[model samples]
Target: MRYPANHVLGAQRNGVNHVSMNMGTVPPGGPVRGTNYPVYPDKLLDWYDSAGAGPMGMTSVRVMFTWEAVQAAANGPVPAPGANYANYWTDLVGVVTRCLARGMVVVLAPWQYNPASKNTDITYQGQPIQPAMFADFWAKLATAVNAATGNDQRVAFDLINEPHTDEESSLPGDIGISLDGWFTCAQAAITAIRSAGNANTVLVPGMTWTSAKAFTTNGSAAKWAALTDPLRNLGVTVHCYSGIDSPGSASPTVLPDACSALVQWARAAGAKVHVGEIAIDAGDNGFPPFGGTLALAQAQWANWQQFCLANDDVVIGWNWWGNSAAGWWNAGDSKHPQGHHWGLSLDDGATRTVYADLIAGSVRTPRLVLHDNLADPGTGENTTTSVAWESPDIWVRQWADGGVVAEPVQGGRSCTVYVRVTNRGTATWPATGTDVVTLHWAKASAGLSWPQPWGGADPALGGRIAADVPIPAPVAPGASTVLAIPWASPPNPLHYPDQDGHFCLLAAVTKAGQPWYDGFTGTNLNTNILRMSHVASRNIHVVPPGQNRFGSLVVENPHREPWRVALAFEPLDPWQQPLPSVQGRLVLRPPEHVLHRLRGMDNLTEAGPGRVALVEPGRGLQGLVLEPGERLAVPLEWEGEAAPALRAVAYDTETGPGTPTGGQTFVLGEVEGWTVEERAALV
Candidate 1:
């Protein structure tokens, strides 16, 4: 949903119940779809509501508050509705009222903890909160909330957020606390709320950050099951990040079964369950430093949401951990720090993430995704040879080669282009044979545009349509299948004998009614390849060592106006760096120079061993000016020596500054052989 720009909790700078300008009628529904809102209130109500069209389509909210904000002193009176802001009472009431008016089911939760106290008790101000004080606080809160909203059944009380022992430690379940200790305080709060004549649902969490898996593993299930509620309207709350109880980087292989344990426990305990907090990083499945793909994050959310929907008998709802600001600031703590990535929207709260559609459950159609780099799915321009093959999903096989290979497009020879597609959605793709996979080829270039660079109905663009293959079998959700298209003759590399003879293959999957592309307009190949899942491009080629290879990169200005463009080559380790066994250097020359020449030229500068930049004589490392639609062929000559493999990415940056506008990664090496077993092992 939407959040304020700053981290303010509620209205009123001091102690006064002020009138909230924003108010509306509450909406009604079931099976809560909600997100966590910041502590305070602000004018950004539409941030989440969006005038009834929720950004996240959220029906409820889990509001956060601190124990200190609720109770100023131990065993002291909890301020009433009109009470001053000494305890944030007025602000709390105002927030709850506003949320209800906007038709959002508000779940009030206390973020109370004092790890330094070194005890299992809920602490306030670094001291243990007495049971009597805890009960008194809940009793007062219940009365205030009841009176404030006429006992709105839509309101809920989440006992506490992620309760655990060893308050000072960041790890959840580090040193286990006695379940009985936590239960005593929880039961007291429940009793207090019920005794206050408030029937709003109460949610109790187990020890160890309320992780679903830990709920039963940590012996919390049995104790929590014993908790008694007079209203019999209680539920269990749990938190999950990357399929675990603790917040950290997401595991690509880890199937999200966060609710499995809780489902079993809930069935046995006969208690409803609510996932209070859940989030996956948008970047590389929400983990940093270790490269990953958006597909990983998409899978996590899809599977989790599916599980929750499937087990609606007990699991009632879930809340995304939070906004971008909180997520980024916490990164320093090394918890779930990539809040921007985890947030539904990017930092701006306007641009939706790739996983937003999945989170919103707005679309249930099949989403077929073809990975550019299997090792790192979302990375479009990949040169990593650490995994034998970068674009494992796409390969070429010819009887002459005797096996499957990723490079060396044998010109004028009959070959089979195999592309693997995975259905990442919840629906199955029917076997109508209409789900077509078309492969388009374009001249090897640092930047290539759609339709024009690659051919369509127009034969003037080199007529580069390689093959179109359709699937004959139904592709079930989460399942993958390979489509093989027989190419009578691939473009003869002999036609351009002076060029490297490498072509960039673009594969797009289309169904009868499904969108032709997933967020890809095809103008920016470099960026779109990484963002779009339904389309993938492969531009890798292997060259023999000690031989000079010439490749022509067609750099064009896609925009209408003239612009200055720069070309830069970045050295990359086909085998991720620091490998002593694999070593090599890449050498480059201008098109005007002879193939055997080793001398540097005036137009080129050695930025590093294998890295070089095209420069103008008077202007140091300058770009060339290109008019609209001007296609410039920049011939590149390069050779590799003394290494298993050498790779570099040639970037065609339009603006000359900041990030490159587009680029392509080229690799030089022997083709990595593929086997029948490897083909069968494709996921």
Candidate 2:
């Protein structure tokens, strides 16, 4: 299996569509602490215990354990009983233990290393707090937790929370920590854990100036690479906010540059990565419609979560900023007269719409789907053989563009076996217009190549086929048909580890049409022929009574590749002839209804193979793309009084010399006593 058993969370069948927010470090060690705001009666911990426990402790809590708490009591005697953690650490054990007894997972975060303030007495030996402090704190915390949760391995830890170079909001003129400082902190912390005989995994943040945070790659990378131990599987935690970027838009799906770049980089590293924090500063204050920050936040969160889902090999989770009430930005409780609030929740116990959305979307871990061996009874030579399938409740049907696509058009993705046979003996194995040479296989995914098995053909259904099939049909002298049909691929069952699997692929078919048109051809959608229920008929007319001056383009050579057609019109001179504008530029006649253009904008912009455009009939008329064996009737007419004559051309680009040419054209003559509505019908 290429993927590990736990990789279901990373199993991006299509991609991830939802993301989480870092709602306040869910009070790691304490009895119960809300955001920066005071917890309701400080007994909020009791409230959580009452709430349904999710997969983790007290609902699978992934809490933060601060270094500031672990390293306090500086130069003093180290104390006899030590810093009193009864309120913070001791109470936390109760939360974890109680939740564990109820079957919940507790994810721990060993917090940051805020180096000493540069100036002031905050300096340690003329330098900011050294790396030793991080290691010291981590070791102490690990020991405390190990002793605390004797039987529960669910008490795993994440290394730090947003480590960075600049220590903002520092005392005025205070020298802050550097990126190199972050490296030392990460390394020392890791070493300390292993030295203490523990194997808890810690997530590490990638080095660089990502988003509004300080600390660029220069120093962070230098310090990180120098680490002595191997830190291969540790996940990368990143922060992303959705404010400012989604301005003026509702349901904004934003993904900013910093977060996007990091996602890409982690992709290459093949390491686990996730957005640790994505916040919206506005708490539904209803600011200006085009609020730049708010817009950016929403868009980034939406796009980032999707990007993460697409790269599940490395990315499997995300957390938007703090929950509860205190917003992430205004933690100081400062007035927002100058700066805006960055928290997603309000102090009045009201929560932002995005708050609940993120938590519902947060990742606890991966879920998997496994099944095997679903095929047909026997194999034959060059004949249509339909296969059977049984799928995990959450199997996903994926496509070529990495989006949801149908089978048949999706090529090799629809079926695993290719049926090929030759008639060298001059004998027809199967008659024409019949399904022959059907290949059978099951569709499923496991770790890497060994994904859990999904759609396996059911043997009970006559050779494991969806519908009963007749005996081996014969093909004529020269005839063929492909047995491509619609098969179901569902997402992981609810509360299942593998909800990521979806649908994929959509496109043209390679098999040729048979003389006998059966339901499979255009009647039913089981096969790959995109047979639309109805097509737009040509509508053209001229001004006069009975004289028909308008014309239609007789579509020959039906389209094989994708197709899109937009009507074009040119202005009429006083002489009443269809001519390009004075500048010879053709006029674009926008369609009344929204047209679903096929994906190939690259060709629309530049000229190349498979490029499509409007074709011209005579003179300056343009051309368009129209594949052979397909039909599309085009309507054309001229506008004028006096029963004048003017030629209207219809064409597709690239179908000719990458220009418009060789198409049906028309000239509208005059009409007498025709109502304007009648004129509309004539033209």
Candidate 3:
């Protein structure tokens, strides 16, 4: 049963307008995901006081405490609430309470997964754990933390955000557990808090969403609905996904369908929703060719956010995911993050005016504009492009329980439909982004929303390519820009080079100051192509006999990116009967002077993904994450002596094991310094 469509939540839900993200870590360094303190407690509060609570506006804040830290030295007993854990929280809880004084809500997120089970896990020292214990343990932690943060309405528990679909989960732990599991788990803590007479509304997920839509479509919706009850005014949170939308591939929408089902279900059930996660990867990537010029997919995401604002009245609250530098989650303004320039605006005070406009009122936003890259348009070359914009004022982003602010006002010309142009861009500067908007584009809607394939369901959701689509010129910041887009033939796009049956053009936006919303859409999408650069390079050489009864060989990738390097060595001379050097540790050094020893079959512990790393590169080194435009050097040497006719094989992670971009195998064929023999036949 769904909650009443117009059910009203009290002041706790409506009055306070603040969002939070689990940033940084415990010791607070690596990833800002779980509990990284993005800034020192004092520094954080200071910034909140000064900067106005990040790009989403509102001055409220929240963070999680490491239960592991509290329970660290537990030996004789699990310790009492007034002991080690209690002391630290006494101070921690005070900080959150202060946010309330400043007109903010202190949302407490306690102990996410202990990472006990799973192929990839967050561990306790070196041991793995069983998941069943997660429930009871969390219950105890909540009990303790509730006391610290005040259960009498000062704080609310986010309650184990996205237990599934995080990086720690198998593929993406973004799916829903049954209502029973949800209830049982939540019941343990809810019952405890209520017993203590605490009124903090607990948070949970509906059917559970993927880091986008990776889960909703995973076939668990019916199962999810099978387990609902009446009195749980519980908040079901979710993370949606618009696959590949991060890269600006327009189409493949996942928003509408998921939101409709969630809203309708909530309306029927009488519960409230809180979107603890939502974001658009704000970057200048491609968009579908509607009129003359294509735009960035990020723009499309912004427009959808406008729709979200319109529906803010329905859900209780929302939280943009994150960004940060010293940490990695919430976009921060420090100087550490490498893979982190994902923030909506540069952390150096260069506010992204477009994105910053979202930081206001702390209410769900409405659509002020609409732009759809229209990724992977209908399988034909003919598509009509139209744009709609609302200059007056609009807003949206990560509505609660997968909902969207879908009310599109006919702002008229403000809603310009760029049907044909070879160019398009931002005003006052080439704001390299696109704002593609579509309501039920997800083959879903509250009335009759979309599922995975919206294009296959609704005709209005798609269009024919407009003639003379524009191609944007190189961007120059702070300058009014205009570019055209031309819609050429064979509409839509496929990820691979040339494949039949086109996918829809789709796009999503990850609010800069946040993490990519666990988002999704209901349609397949096609992305545009950038100028494909085809130039490439490689290097190979044979090493002659060397000291210590061995020889050496080296190979290199002179061009950018770690390339697919190949190496091969068969006996070049028929007279050399190369006896296989049983000791595979024989090594050869490359320009980097790293020695590469032949692997004795026993040395490799083969597993799924790839062979175990015997020479795993350190975190900040160019070991595994090979960079572009750089050469890699490795050395080779053997343990035993051999004839001058043994052949060697060379290959790398890039071009595969046999073929590099050079067209010619980097080291294919026989070597002149040793007897070339089959690896399988070696003694």
lDDT of 3 by residue, 449-531 (tens): 12323333434323322222222433332211222222233222132222111112222222222111111122111101100
Q: Against the true structure, what is every candidate's RMSD?
A: 22.2, 27.2, 28.6
- Top-down TM-score ranking: 1, 2, 3
**Candidate 2 stretches greater than 4 Å from native:** 1-62, 74-83, 95-107, 110-127, 166-175, 206-231, 242-256, 283-300, 325-368, 371-683
RMSD after Cα superposition, model 1: 22.2
How do the candidates rank by lDDT, highest first? 1, 2, 3
TM-score of each: 0.44, 0.43, 0.40
- Candidate 3: Cα lDDT at 577: 30
Tell me which of candidates 1 and 3 scores higher on TM-score: 1
Residue 444 CA error for candidate 1 (Å)?
Answer: 78
Tell me the tens digit of each residue's lDDT in model 1 across 576-623. 232333223334443432222223534655645444544431222234
Which window of 10 residues has the lowest lDDT sum in candidate 3? 527-536
Q: Between candidates 2 and 3, which one is better according to TM-score?
A: 2
Candidate with maximal lDDT: 1
Off by over 4 Å in 3: 1-56, 59-62, 73-91, 111-146, 149-154, 165-183, 206-231, 243-249, 252-258, 284-298, 323-341, 344-683
Model 1 ranges off by over 4 Å: 1-43, 50-54, 80-87, 113-121, 167-177, 244-256, 284-292, 324-341, 345-349, 353-358, 362-683
What's the lDDT of the predicted structure labeled candidate 3? 0.33
